[model samples]
Every structure is written in structure tokens, then in C-alpha cells.
Target chain A: MIAEGRIVIDLSRNGDVRLTSNRGADVARLLVGRDPREALDLLPRLFSLCGHAHVAAARVAVQEDVTEAEAHADTSRVLAETAREHLLRILTGWRVEGAGFELPSPPVMGLVKNMQAAVGDPAEERQVSALLAGYLETHVFGISPAAFLKLRDLAEFTNWLDGGPTLAKAYLCQIVAHGWQGLGAVSTQFLPALSGAQLQALMAEPSFTLRPEWHGQPHETGPLARQSRHPVVAALLELHGAGLMSRLVARLVDLAKIPTQMTTGESPVRGQPGVGVVETARGRLVHAARQEHGQLKDYQILAPTEWNFHPEGVAVQALAGLHAVTGRAEGAQALIEAIDPCVAFEVRAA
Target chain B: MCLAIPAEVVAITDDKQTATVSLEGVRKDISLALLTDVEPGDFVLIHVGYALNKISPDEAARTLALMAELEEVSS
Candidate 1:
């Protein structure tokens, strides 16, 4: 049997949390020497979550330019997938009430259907977007996505949080009631967007993917960093300082913005010499590919998890700061959830 | 990066809520909540104790061969 690596958080009796990543299998190495198109086709089969983002980055990495239609198709697919991913994580991954919620239910199944439709046909983009927006409005937000997106401050957020009986409200409420809004705050910087050539150069260094740093500092990425400048997220950063509350809320804010992102079609940053970067649900996903002797050679992937979960990155820094308080495991889990590692994770006694 | 490993469904529970999947020889119970109409012998991509989706046997074989190649190279 093959080992699909996962993150293990070992918490000592003294409330010091240690993080270990077993994701040592360099799967990207397999793509080397293969036809770029074949490699792209294998991406979705290899990665069940964020597969669209993977394919999009790989497409940009192997091709120097993307036409308007391709870009729109790419943006639509990724955004649709992102909406489904965030919803699944919040609904199924969050174990807020001690025992986690059961799955295969209507909401979860609905998301899976939409997720499949996302990777299917370009003409289905509008239909998928409408279904997703309707799902969020009726089930999670208790308000229209546009209305939720316009909430700009803590008061607005708190009112919305308390104004509904939605699952999103319940999870956020638990964090607030437990005063975990500020738990696991860190001073890690946000990763800056690098040009395709710049990113290609960075990946040339063997260790860049495992412990990526922007100008020698390990910066956080993903939704929180991406949404840091949003008015509501800005207010959140000011209040919580990149803690559990801000991270969770940032995910919500990002989800609420998906429909607009689909309709508007934000141009993705291009990568020259076959390097492509895209801001995925979890964070930025970078893929670098170059041809040698008429064949694809030297392919590398830098997933957002690498940046946030680096050995000396934000997750460890935040978890290590936990004091031996009551319910330390729950706090640690919540913090990890806020950071949202893309892989499976477990928290246990050291 | 999140990489999902493909496993064969050996036996499904009576409730149809979960399935017993075997990866090579390793066996585990995975939630079937995210999928429908899965049968024994079908290959599904397993991630974090959940079966993301079902795949054709040919597709599963190709993916596993690629993974095995990577493992050999790393070793």
C-alpha cells in the first residue's frame, strides 16, 4: 500500500504543540520527462481536492500564453471548485461539537455534485455558479452572498454571526464563545506575488518548496492573506491579528466573493518559461515546467501548504505558543483548522 | 499539495454510508457520504478517511504505476 502523507500535531503535556509533516514523497517528480499535456491530464486524477487549481497552474506553466476564452474557462473552473472546497471543509471538516458532523447528507452531496460539474463543461459555468450561490445563501449564510460580502466590520460580522442558525454561524460562534478568536496569533508575513520567471528561479533552489520564504521570511498565504485587504478582513486582522477568528472569517469572505469573481473574470498572473501561479482556496499554487531537448523536463510544484506548514512556518509558530490551558487539543485543532492545511491532519498527545 | 491514493472497495457496509477499501493490502473504512452508486471492486480516491470519487480501473492502474515509479526513484 502507498502512504498518502498527512500532518501530525504532537502536543506535549506542557501544552507545547509540535508539528510533523510526513509528505515526503515527491509526486511532482513523476511529471518530469512526460509530455506536458499528459502531465496536466494526470493532475486531476492525482489530486482530488483543488485538482482544478493544479491543472490551471500546470497549464499556465507549460504554455507561455493563454487566450481570453481559456483564461475565462480556467478562472470559472477554479472559482467554482474553490467555492465547493471551502463549503466542504466548513461543513464536514469542522468538528466543533466534540464529535464531527456526519457526511453524505444533502448539503455535502450537493457540493460534490457541483464540484463534479465544475470540472466537466465550460458551458456549465453559469449553472454551477448559480447553484453554488443559491446553496450558500440558503444553507450557510442565511443571507445573499452579496450581502455577506458587504459586511465590513466586527459589529457587522457579529450581528451576522448571531443573526442566523446556519452551520457557519455555529462554528464561528464556538470559536468566539471559547474566546479562541485570538488563539494562535503569529507575526509571519504574507507572501508577495512573484512573476513567472521569478518563481521559476526560486524553484530552481531544491529547498524552496519545502520551506519557501519571501525575501528570507516565511510568509503565510491562502485565503486570509489573499483577503487581508478586504474591508471586513482588514478589520478582522486589526482585531484578531491573524488568529482563528480572522482566518475562519476570511474563508467565509472569500467564499462570498466567488460569484463576483466568476462573472468579472480576474486575469490570472502569467508565468514565463512555463511557470504558473494561481491563488487557490488554501493559498497560492505554483507549478514550474521547462522543456529540454524537445521534451518536458524539470517540473516542480509549490503548494500553499508548504508555505504555511513549513517546519518553521506559521502553523508551528502559532501552535508552539499555546499554554497548558483547558481544552488545549480543541484549541490546537481549531487553530490548525483556521490555518487549513490542504492534507489530512491529526492532533494527539506526544 | 494534497495527493489522493486510489484504493479498491472490497466490501460496503449494509447502511451504504461507508465502505471497506483496500490499498494494495492495507484495509480501512472510509466514508461514502460524498459519493453514490459505488460497488465492490470499484476504485475510489481516498483522502483523509473520505472517498472523494470513483474512478475507472484502468485510470486507477495508471495512477498507481506512476506513484510506484516515484517511490522507486525516491528510494
Candidate 2:
């Protein structure tokens, strides 16, 4: 296994969200000057949480495409991994805070099989939907998928939080209990859709693959960015901005969309200058490769963590001027986890 | 793709999604959101915050021994 990367965050008396990591260096070492095939093979080994999405991004980055069946398979696999990642975060978050929760993995592989069957037959498709609805109701939202999907405003979301038995409600309660409402506030600086030329310019830096920037400013990628288009997300944006709660809720809610994406998402293939923009469970991931003479001439990967946790980026911006309702130490840790670095992190109060 | 370790579930919550797990007095909350069947006292392989699989005590010991051996070789 690729050793999990480390992040060191320092919360100073002045309330600075000072964060640092060497994960980019690890990625650069693995990718730069390496064969595309080897790097693609290593993607899953390195990124265990959402390996399928990493693989898909690499395939897209290499100007590769899969048939419709393969594309559906890839999407379904990634969706399964994403749901697992979200559940893990929730389970881990609750437990670390002293919740006595059990550990039981969802039937990820089985869901993929069922989703495949659903792709061809309506009956199996309904079965898949009903199955997901049951699981999400019991674990995620405490409401039917239809009701959860019907929530289009903060009022509805608030009602759901007030009475819903879902993990989303529990997570919201945690944030509010910690007095983190409007805490760790980040601007909605979505990474703009890029042209091939722009992508080339962004990837020109030696550190681009691990820590990409647009116009020299850091942005966010991941569930929050991907689901910013949803009605509930839009309401949250208007009401709460992108805080810790908003980010976490967006993550859980994204589970509702994965099945649909699997059945209707675009082909996971692109041609030339292969710049693949994929949304992993954590955030947006980009993999681009340039091939010449039947060999990889250049390759780069941009992970969501790189953008959100950048030294002077979203994490710092969110933590700036944090009031620290609890203690600086606890508040800082909460804020960091709110930004949710894909890798493990260490917190220090100085 | 990753490694998980055997842990004992000491307590379970009302929601059944979170539980307290222990490994030698150290405790953690493991998410049960993924599995259809699990309970406190179950021994499971833990990774991140999710319980990966159930294991027998003997099997857990054997896996740990192999892991320790691999660490030694790597070192």
C-alpha cells in the first residue's frame, strides 16, 4: 500500500489556518517521467478510497475511452467507491467523537452488479433504486429518496435536520453543537472549465500535478463543487455559504446522484491531449497526458485535496478569523476535517 | 489496496451506524453503515473508519503476524 500521506496543521493564537503537506511531492515522484501504463496501474494502489475514479480519470487523461458497457461499469464502480468513502467518513467522524457505532461495509460490488443489470432491464433497475433508497433511508437521510430529493430549499433542509434520522442530520447537529455555523467559511471558487491550452499552461509548473492553480488562486474540487448545481446545494449556498456542514451534507447527498450518473453519464473517454476531469468522492480530480511517437510525452494529475488544502488556499481561507467557540485546538481540528483532506492529517496548537 | 486490522466492537449506538471498537484498550467508532449485519462483540478488520470484514481470533492473529513479518522485511 502507498503509505497514507500526512498533513500538519498549526492553529496560531492569531487564528491562522496554517497547513502543510508533502503529498504533492509523492504524486510528482510517482508520475513525472514515468510510463502512462505503469502510472495508471499504480493509481488504484495509491488511492484506495476511490480507486475506480482514479483509474477512469487516468484512462480519460490518456485519450482512452471505453464502450458504453465499460463506461457504465466504470461509473457504477466509482459510485460504489464514493458512497463507501462518504460512509467511512461519517462512521469515523461519529466514532472519533465517542459514538459507539458498528462497522459494516455496504454491498459495493453487489450494487455494481445490480446497477449493471438495471442498465439492461427496468425491473432490476427498480430493484436497484429501491435497494439504494432503503439503505440511504436507514443510514443517510432517514427519509425516502424521493422526499430527500424533493428538498429544494433551506426550510426543507432545516426540517429534515430537525426530524430526520439520517447521518446527515447527525452531522449537522455535530457542527451546530460545536458552534461551527458560518465557521470555516470558503468562497465558491469553482475550477473553471478548462480548454486544452489553459490546461497546458496550468500543468506547466513542476508542482502542477499535485497542486494545480487557476490564475494563481486556489479553488475547491469534490462533492461540494460537483453538486453545487443541485437545488439543495444552491439553497445552502444562498443561506449558509460553503461551511463545514455544507460541505459534509453535500457529500452525503451526492450518493443520491451516483446511480443516475452511472446510467446516463457521458462516455468515460476523450480524444487527444487527454485532459480528464473526474469527480472523485473527495472532490474533482484531473489527469492529463500527452502522447507522442506511441509513448507518453507528458502526464499530470490534479487531486481535489491539493486545491482545498493548499498552503494559501481554501482551508486557510476558511479558517481565517475563526472565532474558536470551543478551544482553538478543537476548532482548528474541526475546521480541518470540515475541509476534509483526502489524506490523514495531524493538528497542532501553537 | 489498503490494510485493515481486527478490532472488537465494545458498544453499539441506537442508530446502528456507529460503534465503539477496541484494540488493546484503545477505542474508536467504526461505521456500520455499509454492512447489513454486524453487532457489538463482533471482530472486524478496520480501515479508515469502516469495518472491512469479520475475522476469527486465530485468523486475526495470523494476519497480524504476517504483517509484522512484512514490516520486518521492509525495514
Candidate 3:
């Protein structure tokens, strides 16, 4: 099997933090010179975490033309996948934060499996969205998605967090109790919406794929950046300034709105040397392909992990400022989770 | 960039909540918390110490061969 790389986070006693990743950026080179359709089919086998997103991006990148309906369907599938991903993270990953929090693994796993099973079938879009919304209502929010979305201020948010004992609530309450709401806050420049041509040009540079920066500045992406303008997240961001709380709440905001936000217009370049950009669970995922006579001459993928986990990127900047101590490891790990790398990670404190 | 390699389940624990999986002769135990109906000799995709799902053996073989090819290229 291809190497499933790991991220090593070392926290020193003097409050210094270093992040190292063995994640291979050259994995996409495997697609070079293959037929675009063949590469698209192979993507699911390659990327099991966000496999649907990868296939969707590669499909658009390789398509000579896209119909309105096809674009709408693709957008729907990606949204469903994103919601599934958020649910998995909230249910499974957050369970480690609270001693009393036990993951309801069976139902959560069942829901994710059902959602994944429907990913490639556009006819199952409505079913998938309904499944995700129902799971959120029963397992996560303990309220309807609509009601949760209407929560506009920090008071309402805290009231909701205090009311539930689910994994999401337990972990969030700890964040509040520890006063880690503002932990990891930093000056933020969100990645902006770019046209296909603009994105293609930027992605052509080799350094851009491994250590991407927009206009010489490290910009943040993913649910927090995408949903920062939402009323609930905006209220949190206004209070906390894009810290752990704001980031986690933004993921909820994004997941709650997925059923209603399926009409995103993806403007992929139409022919050879095509480029497709998609918003995934972690952040923006870009795929570029250059084909001659129906075979790819060049292929490249720029995943969100690279941008958020860049040597001088958002994750490092947030972790660097903290005073490394015994009790701070939990917050540091939570911060990394809020930033959300696609690979496995280890937190080593010394 | 989110590539997840599949591993072969060589043995199941007595409690049935975990399994020992093998990949290219390397062995490690993984939780079966996210999946059910897994058996020895099944190929499963793993992430963060959990087995995400089971895959067909043919698909498993194809992926392993491709991964070997990737190792050669990167090496």
C-alpha cells in the first residue's frame, strides 16, 4: 500500500513547537501520463479519506465540457461528503477530550457508511442529505439543523453546548471551561475565491503544491474560513478572533447548511490543461490535468493539508506562540484538530 | 494527497473489537470500532488507528500493486 504519512508535533519545555510531516506531495505524480478517466477511477482507491472529493475534482479537471446538471450533482456529492467528514470528526476525534464522553460508534459508523455508499450515485443525493441532517439532529446538535442555524450569538451557542452531553458538546464545554476559546488565535487572511485560470496559474508552480501561500501570505482555508461570514460563526469570530472555538463552531455551521448549499458553481477550465478547484472538509482541493490525445501529459493535486500544514502556515503559527507545559498538550492537540490535517498525527511533549 | 492505504486483517481479537492487520509484512493492531462483519483475510482501509471499511480482495491486490509501483517511483 502507499505510505500513509504521519505528522509529528514536538512541544519543547521552553514553549517552542516544531511540526514535521513526511506526507508525500508527489503521490499525484502517479496519475501522470494515464488517461484522465482512468486516473479519475483510480482516485477513490488512492484517497480513502476524501475519496469522493478527489474523484469529483479529477472528473471536472478532465471533463472537456460540463453540463449545468452535472455540476450541480457534483456539488451535491461533495457537500454530502463534507458533512459526513465533519460528523465523523466531531463524533470520533472529539471523544478523547472528555473523560465521560463515549463515542456512539455504531450509529455514527453506520451513518458514515451509508453516506459513503451514496457518494458516486447522484440519484441518492436527497437520501444522503436527509441521512446527514437526521444524524446531526439526533446525534450532534440535539436540535433540528434549522434551529441550530438560527443560534446567532455566543450566549445561545453556550446554552446549546451546556444542554447536550454528546461528544461534540462535552469537548466544546471543556474548551469553554479551560478558557481555550481564544487559544491559537492569530492574524488571519482567508483564501479567496479564484477563477479557474487564476488557480491553474498558481498551481503550476512546483513550490505552490508543497508549500502554498497566496500573494506571499499564509492564508487559512476550510470550514472556518468558508463559514466565517455566517451569523453564528461571525459572532464567535468577533468575540474570539478565529481561535479553537470559532474554528470548531464554523465546522458545525458549514455542516448544518450543507443540505441547502448544494448549488455551488465550479468553473473548471474546459479543455486540455484543465483545472478544477473544490471545497473539501479540510479546505480547498485543487486538481490540474494536461492531456494530449486523451492521455494525461501532466497531473498535479494541491490538497488543503499542504496549505494549513505548511512549514510557516496556519498550524505552525498557531502552535508556536503557546507556552509548552503539562496542561497545554490537550489544547495544542485540539488546535491541531481544529486545523484538521488529512493524515495521522502524533503529539509529543517534552 | 489524502491517500489511505489498505491493510490485510490477519487475526481478530477475542473481543472482536480489534484486529491485527498486515501491510507489506508489517503488523499492527487496529480498532474495529468503525466497522462490523470484518473477518480474517479481509482487506480493510485504516485511518488513525481505526478500520474504516472492508474492501474486495481483488481491489486490495490491485491497490497493493499500485502502491508498490509508487514506492519504486519515489525511491
Candidate 1 lDDT over A194-238, as tens digits, reads: 776688789888789888887887889988888888887888788
After superposition, the stretches of candidate 3 with alpha carbons farther than 4 Å from their true spots are A67-70, A96-124, A262-273, A324-326
Cα deviation at B73, candidate 1, in Å, is 2.7
- Better-scoring candidate (lDDT), 2 or 3: 3
Question: With candidate 3 superimposed using the best TM-score fit, by how many Å does residue A268's alpha carbon deviate from the native?
Answer: 12
lDDT of each: 0.79, 0.65, 0.78
Best first by lDDT, ranked: 1, 3, 2
DockQ of candidate model 3:
0.63
How much is A123 displaced in model 2, in angstroms?
A: 6.2
Docking class of 3: medium
The residue-by-residue lDDT of candidate 2 on A270-294, one tens digit each, is: 3234676666677777777777765
Better of 1 and 3 by TM-score: 1
The number of the candidate with the highest lDDT is 1
The predicted structure with the larger TM-score, 2 or 3, is 3
- Compare the candidates by DockQ and give the number of the best one: 3
